[model samples]
Target: MGHRHKNKKLGILIFLVVCVLFLHYCTIHDVVLRHAIYRMLFFLPLVLGSFWFGLKGAIFVSISIIIPYIPYVYHQWNGFYQEFDKFLEAGLFVFMGCLLGYLSEKQQREQEARLKAERLAAIGSAVSQIAHDLKSPLMAIGGFTKQVTRHLSIDHPDRKKLDLVISETFRMEAMVKEMLDFGRPFQLQKTEENLNHLAAECIEISLPFAKSSGVDINTEFDPEITVRPLDSNRMKQVILNLLTNAIQASSSGKIVSVRTKREKQGVALDISDCGCGIKAEDQQKIFEPFFSSKKEGTGLGLAIVKKIVELHGGHIILFSNPEGGVTFSIKLP
Candidate 1:
């Protein structure tokens, strides 16, 4: 990564220096009378470098051109009336260049962070699946070891040692299964399905858990709305993930709702939770993998939902409500 960044910086600086030379020579006929275009030229390297190759690239461009600017500066030094305007032009050019470059770098950093989160979420999901799959076998191993221990003589130290081995193996196996589940990728197959039907199924499965947590879920959807292409199982997962998250996030006596409608350009699936909304700083990271509000959450649920939505060529947008809740919008194209 460092080498690639260094190479990108080198390439951009070279390109910017070439631009500066071309601009300098192109205006040679008007050398004695400095032109506004030259001031504009001052930003060519900095702006281009910063916007594409980031801050380091822009700094390199700036350093490369700054030395050349000195000769031009000295040439017009004696013109008393023009000094202020000349300095102002230079300052503004440099400031805007650096500012734009910094902003570009910041955006790239944010995007990179999102990608990292998604990868971790994917890992988490694999872990969850593996953990689920291994529970029965691990249980059997532990149970057999326990049964065998009771049959052995109380003085049999070897029996107890075997039980310890069984116990440790189960623990290691559980961790291995979790790692597998979290590392696997999801496969989505879309078919036309009722949005309301999917939501109902998810709610039914999670209803018992939600009730135990003292949360309520409600849904309103068009009964005969035109069916759109969707992956029923995956959509069920998405609904359950979102609804489960909503229920877990909601405080005692809070309610969550699932609603759908035909909106301009696409169909909309909205899930609103009257729970404590996400913190302002965490809103953007909410859909990122391994990022969660719940203490026990693995954080892959929402990340998988986002990936599924995006795979369907849909948009998932979230925001905090003034009512101290959260509104999630998924628009599928």
Candidate 2:
């Protein structure tokens, strides 16, 4: 990579010098130089070169083509006209160069985004496989540890430590399973279902937690709308995660709202909480796997939710305002 970079720099430098020399030679032209049309035409290419190679390349090309014309700029009015024409021509070349450069830059960015998405997709598959492998063993381990605890004498010095291990292992196992499901791409288990029904179900399930946290839960759903080809269970999990996170982030007695409605793309689900908003710097990193600002947070919840939404041919956009709140708008097709 280092060598390649050096070579690129060297190549650009050589091209600049050669162009400069060529412009100097053009200035010495006799009959050919006297022709205004030919002289302006010569610099057009240089203008384009500047656009491609940036200001330096254009400058080099201009010197090569325009240096020849500079003397004529004052000598003959016809020559001046020719110079003006050539100046316009060079401007066009530079404009063309800029257009091309802008396109090239835009293309590179799209390619990078696509590649990143592909990489994340591949990693998701691998994570699913690893999570699957760990599930059975984790269950077995938990069961064995429980049995050991029961068989051990009540006064055993290792009891508390062993129980803690067992508890943590179970939690880890659940988290791993959650990741597997989130990253795993499965066939669309599409069925006709009511969007309002799903939202209501999730609310009921999460009510206990809401009561404990003192965060009020509000819901809005269109009952007449029908949405299908969705994994309701997975969608429920995503809602639960988002709402729970909101609760944790909010002060007691705050309000967290979940609203669902039909959009042109599909269904729009907005989950907003009147909690402390995520910091600007942290916002971009929020969806990264295993990243969390909360104490005792696994950090994988949002990552998993993002994957699940994407896999469903949907998108999740997060926004926060100075009102001290975060809103996650999920669009699903």
Q: Highest TM-score among the candidates is held by which one? A: 2
The TM-score that candidate 1 achieves is: 0.58
Which tens-of-lDDT digit does each residue in 1-333 have in candidate 1?
499886876786677676765566566544645556665666766777887777766666766776776775676476757677867776676676677778988999999989877766666666667677777777777778877888889788788697787879666664554345346666778898877778778888998998999988888886655778888987876778788778877887988888888877878888899886888889888876667777754565676688778778897999887787998898887
Best by lDDT: 1
RMSD (Å) of each candidate, 1 decimal: 10.1, 6.7
**TM-scores for candidates 1 onward, in order:** 0.58, 0.67
Give candidate 2 regions above 4 Å deviation: 1-102, 125-133, 148-166
* Quality of model 2 by C-alpha lDDT: 0.73
Candidate 1 — worst ten consecutive residues by lDDT sum?
174-183
